[model samples]
Target: MYQFDKRIVMTLDAGGTNFVFSAIRSNEEIVEPITLPSNGNNLEKCLETMVTGFTAIKLKLPEAPVAISFAFPGPADYVNGIIGDLKNLPAFQGGVALGAFLRKHFGIPVFINNDGDLFAYGEALAGALPEVNRMLQEAGKNKVYKNLVGITLGTGFGGGVVRDGELFLGDNGAAAEVWVLRDKRQPVYGVEEGISIRAIKREYAQLSGDLRMLSPKDIFEIAEGKQAGNMVAARETFNHAGEVLGEAIASINAVVDGIVVIGGGIIAAYKYLIPAVMRELNGTLEMYEGTSVDRMEMKAFFLDDVADRDAFLVSTSRRIMVPGTTETIEYDSVKKMGVIMTRLGTSKAIAFGAYAFALNELDKC
Candidate 1:
């Protein structure tokens, strides 16, 4: 997804080793990136590296950047650009004012956010949210969505929320920490135990009666019947993971209603994952009084399925006339939500997210 606004924004893909710096305009990279060692163990060196890299990017850009925006691993006060103690970067042990320093150095606005929040923002602005709306419009629906929940499945389950074009960072800047949800299969363990890369390997090992520590990709190939392992075990592994992921999403929807979009390396195996997810989401909840309620008020549909998409796009809204007046209004009775995989790859989504976020904030100023 590309931004049409021509304003320039400098961005970084902050990593433990190489700190990548580039400038973006119209939601696309405009200059070759400069990479420098992060020196994450040394704050002085880390700060210097960022300054150097951003300076180089600025020199190569066609014009001055309007702001600086990027993602960093966080236990942060993102509203103020103060990073808290991080496990990956020891130099950020204290509340370091990363954003304030960048603003001072570049003499422009600086905004820093975590990847999860930005991922959802990116999708809400230009990716899954827009695509879903377009599909609904094509199907002759008048309902337009303005909220989204984006999740990533890989090393750890992560999530973020976007409501009406704004990234919904909570009061403490820790919203949508879905990995910490209780596992559906093992209540004692975090949900990530059932939904992540390690979860796939561990489950496949136990199911196939093999302990060779096969990679997740290998297990996926096995499930595809292209590798020499138990196809049943591999498919079962992903199914269990999807169940846990769906449980987490159901819980999230209770608080924030939105279309859900999934991404990350683990999504390569989504063929085996999403069906279980829909089952779990559409499953019922039982009350102490012995009554059963739908887990979600709206039915969850996987957008990739032609039948599901058709069902989701079928709206049951009606025009109602007022009793006391000539006024009439439209009312929607059918409830539904769509879930889909990312359209933009994860990295590009994050990059464009940063670029778009910077411009949006600037416009508000």
Candidate 2:
């Protein structure tokens, strides 16, 4: 399904509830995306589902894909392509050698990384950090150095780090695993703790004595309307999580002057809880006169409108790497062709392609 003239890269972000996949050509061209239920029983089911998805993608491409990349949930051994134990995703425990399997089956290079790290990479490469840096430079401040952090408040807290414009994977690849803190200790000490959606639901059931909740979305909606007597508890829960996040950012700031690029479904309630978070952060960080903490300086990303900005960033990056080539041409042509693949959405496909592209690039090193 791939074309002789076009290159293909696949990326996937496997979550607890769902697995999102994308096949992109370069940074701009999206080749469609596939979504399937995430069965975490083991690597077998995941591999089966992925292979099937790849087959479907092949039908539309002109030739075999050039490379593959993945952004997997939980702790990932990116340097060696081995996955670590993930709590919610039962199937991924004891690690998965995803790269070796993909290579054996497809005869192509494959690269994989943590989902949180990919999000951070995208943000640092294209998101809030770039904008902030450009603004600072234009104002005549020595271009702010690249110490960055990205946090995702989804099924649980996910975090990643970047320093000097590159992803900083520590000696063990677990450098930014900040969400594993225990709830009681985290709340009191102002440290960020990762709270699963399931935990929130359990809390609601305990307080209201109703065990028939449909989804986190429904629960939050009702709580927002104050229809379920769940608003108080939900607000407390979110605020506590936000406080933890802010405290963590403060700790991170002590070490690096990086912007915190936040994303994920849980961040949807950002507006509701950011105030408390900001308050806690300010309380802790007020003494540091050099840290930037003003309203204009610290801005949260709105995923709705700021959507494909990451695509633009990635495209720009691809252009930078390939000098003398008109970047616009690559972006426009690839974006047009890739969007033609399907209707699933951009994030899935872009992540897939980006992952694939990353793997191919790493192989050269």
Candidate 3:
């Protein structure tokens, strides 16, 4: 591990509504953060705001920052540090060469990445995955988890994958864009249509037959109230959201089987969402059981007893013939996978992720 105590980097969390600035040490210590309105509609003002925030932090530092890193939203080129036209921040139209701009202005290396991807890297390196690995090691399980999927549920559903201790950006840097996957109910709509804050409001409205504007927090409050009808509606909304999320996760698992770490504002209602997600995952395991069987088959031995080998293979196969349907199905063996709330919270996780990512990049030089 790099010596984090001796390294500090300037960090920015360029959120949809706010531009939060801070400095983070490799040790995961965060300096005071300043939050400012994004002013996202005006590109000039947005750039100026970022420069001003970094300048102020630079003035307070005993030594100049080693590098600058940002956790930014994206549909653009993360590898090149460019930001595409963002729905929330219209000023970023036509894609901005943000990394080059920042590097030129600050005279230091600058790195930028999608917020969801950075969050996943942070949690895997310093948060949930590490905690889980420690516990498993202490329990003498001889297993350590190094792969994880991170999901953020807020204005939209965001996803990132970390495999074998490295962030998986895919060939085109659009690897974990889970939101675009088809929805279960309406194939025309993507997974985000059923899992985002808007989805919650839409579901709640349909359930209650009331179309009044309501935030997810407002819906959660109603669920906690004594009104039976509203409570059921609210619960059902979250339950459906969880089911959608679980389905998306299972699909991702087919490609990369690992624990999932969930974060963002909506996760505050995890108590209501998790059970529903687990229920969906339990029901949908059959869809991915083939992958699990393949893994188990890799361990099967030719020397095993004839009956024992057959029975073991049959159990792993999980194949069942459908009654009167000329169809067969496979069920998963209830593989141990975890879905847990993030321990680092959102902001700190992003900050630490920025710091860690900068260090890794700088090391290459």
Candidate 4:
């Protein structure tokens, strides 16, 4: 396909372990994306590297993208355009003036958001939340839905909340830190520490006292086969996870009633474990006949190139783009890190995409 008047938007997901960048032309079509190992040990040095890389990517733009949206693996004062003390990302602890720095250099608007928050917002705008919402709407008058909770289990767990169609970050945009599950039973450890994939492995091994080593994948396989020792161990460990997860969700439900959507590699291993999770959640609910325990609805998202998944591209195009506007086409099949975001340092592109989205929405207001 050939085109004229093309507009490019770049998005970045700078994570602790991996950084991915993607360039989207009108949502579906990708011009390029790149991925790289991240070394966020030093803030100024990493930002410097990012700037250098972005310069190179600009040379290949299909006519400089309209905006950029960046997702950083840290705490950010999104309203003020400052990165706060991100515990996992030591380099950005004190805070980075990402917005001013980008604007002075590129003369383009940029937007920043917490990766988990953006992930959930984008999912609702474009991915799994829609499916879950549809199911709730079907549940009819009994439905008490008001928000969207996204739980992602990757290197660690990522929690995000969406209320009334917008990312609800509370005063500081940190409302979705649901991984900090306080288990009185465990006393010392939080939920992430006790039930994350890493924790599950340690608990399983310690209880079994098996000298033989096993990967998390192996644990799931053993659980699937219902093997005697492994099943007993797996059931015990995962049931604890479900209980912790249920508690977290129940607490959130008290504040903002909504469906919980759980994703991530670990959950993929044992899809059947949700039943145990739902059972545990039932114990937490104090229903008086009318309300009863129901399975928490879950959905999986594209694990790769998540930065450019265009959660709102389809909806935006349909609502805003002109009819017969073949000049711009959207495709969601390609799965690769954007060139600028991953290798050439395209954090600006990400910030730009997000800014564009925010501006567009603001205009509708």
Candidate 5:
């Protein structure tokens, strides 16, 4: 939203094998990215690579960067920028003060955070949240939203919460770890077991007597009757993921009470997943007395559904008179939430998140 801000932030896209570094100004990349090997098994080389990458970007800029910010794999002390044991980057298994090293080297403020958190923050700052509000305004509605929950469904299930334009990083730096929740379909496994790439393949394979694994893309195509695979089995696989994802999101919504935006590769098949998600959200829970209660207090609407999007944008407020006075005030009592796929690509969202976060924090100082 603050695309006119003049401050520059150095950012990187850290991956398992490489570090792609660049500088962001006005919420956009200002230069071509510089790449370097991550050398994840060797701490010394990995650290050096990060420094080199940032330094190269720094030299190309005519202006000094005000801060350094980027996302890394988590299980980290993000507040202090210390990385914990990472399965992909084994050299950090013993913990490393990555943020501190960068600050000392560059003599600028350094901020590090989980990718999920940054992704949510980015969307909250510039993507889905604002777009929805703009829609409401254009529709001449008074309803406005101030919170969002963003999730990524790719290699694993991941999420972040943003409220009132602030990313919610909970105590112990482990907030929004949705993947660890118990799977409803498999009590012995985490929810991630039923919501990831592998989940689609595993479920599709198990559905057929031949028991062959297939990529999620190919399976989705099969479900569209465009490829040579079991169509029913492929559709069921996505439904399975949707059921578990819905459970996790509904539980999260109880606390967040906001809009939900989903990203990652799997969301491309939202058509198949969202119906199952809606079923679980609108489903009921049983009481000891055999009464069925709505699954969530706030009804979750899939925004891709044209009718649902219209409902979400409609104003539910009206003027009400006080019981014992002549005074009246406008009030709204609708409790609802909307979920949709991310319009902004995940990587761009993360980069914008880093850029916005750094500028915000710098302003505080």
Candidate 6:
């Protein structure tokens, strides 16, 4: 197994707008980063830019980097380190064999993964989950949360899952691709239509009936400033998004039951989003509450004199009733699943994740 202590690797964070290059050590310390335009429309220029950036960073390091690792947006084969038909960068319509190409040129092992997956992995290892577990320990709770689901709300919605401290890629490296799931209310639209920056604007426009193209930031400013006519629309938009997100989380919890860490530019307005999400989740818990038959009988006896006994029984039937126990049953609730913002910013999280992933791969060799 490779010892990660003091080891350094070349890391890249590729996005639609820019390619950020830097050297990061095992301890998550990052060196100066060089930012270059992604040259996204031209594959040749994009490849050249990445090579040039890494070469420059390599020259500055005292020792050659042990490997190269990066987080790339995907619709491609992450297992094979190929990027497929990136919609934003049309020049990559013919998939790029990124890992092999980089390894050949740099003469080192190269690792690549979906940006969202790596972001979640970083949070699981060094950011949100660790912080949460620490807090749990400090508060004298025996429970430690290891699984996590991370979501990014930017131009689009992206999601990833981590289980037991490792990224969960599922059978085809597409386990947590939550954005593609059909929307609960609009079957024609995917979940991303309700969770993205565009979604926020669409909701605001629908609510306010003003079709002028407005960014999420603009809507946020109006809402935060309590602008008379626009605030209600903006607030409703966020709250609706949150409720949709909560439903998505409930579905995810049914499978993974993990904590959630949210990131991306949209999270700047988390103050408006989180409460609505919590309210929806809490409501769902109440809706699914488990009760005992004895407890129901006790309630029925107490309410027999009441005029509204039938209505109370109808409401009580919604809860799952266990037999032979008058005592209140303590059922596990979904609300126990914590949600928090990412402690590590996007770039740092991606960079550190790439570095850690590279090291883990090296250890196996």
Error of 5 at 219 (Å): 1.7
Write the candidate numbers in order of decreasing lDDT.
Answer: 1, 5, 3, 6, 2, 4
lDDT score for residue 203 of model 5: 86
Q: In terms of lDDT, which candidate is stronger, 1 or 3?
A: 1
274-340 in candidate 5: lDDT tens per residue? 9988898888999999899998888777787889899877778889999999999998776788887
Give candidate 1's whole-model lDDT: 0.88
lDDT (CA) per prediction: 0.88, 0.58, 0.77, 0.56, 0.88, 0.75
Query: What are the candidates' C-alpha RMSDs?
Result: 2.4, 11.1, 9.2, 12.4, 1.7, 8.9
Against the hidden reference, what TM-scores do the models get? Answer: 0.92, 0.70, 0.84, 0.69, 0.95, 0.83
What tens digits encode model 4's per-residue C-alpha lDDT throughout 1-365? 11232566556667776566665553343645566555677777767655654555566676876555667655577755688786666787777888678666776666677655655555544455455445335534122334666666655667767776677768765687776767534857776776577777886787677546766667777777744456777667666666666566556655555555555656655444454554554453337876854332222122222332333122322223447874644543411110000110122322333543554544455
Off by over 4 Å in 5: 209-213, 317-321, 325-331
- Tens-place lDDT per residue, model 6, 1-365, is 11256788998878788888888776455568889999999889999998999999998787878999887887888878888998877778877898888899999999888777878888888888887777667655556787988888887778889899777888887788888876655768888888788899999999999788788888888789744348888888888888777667666656777777888888887777776665555553323356422211111111112332222222222244477866455443222556678888876676667777888888879
* Cα lDDT for residue 16, candidate 5: 92
lDDT of 2 by residue, 104-154 (tens): 877877777766676666666555565666644665545364666776655
**Among all candidates shown, the one with the greatest TM-score:** 5
Model 4: lDDT to the true structure: 0.56
Least well predicted 10-residue stretch by lDDT in candidate 1: 1-10
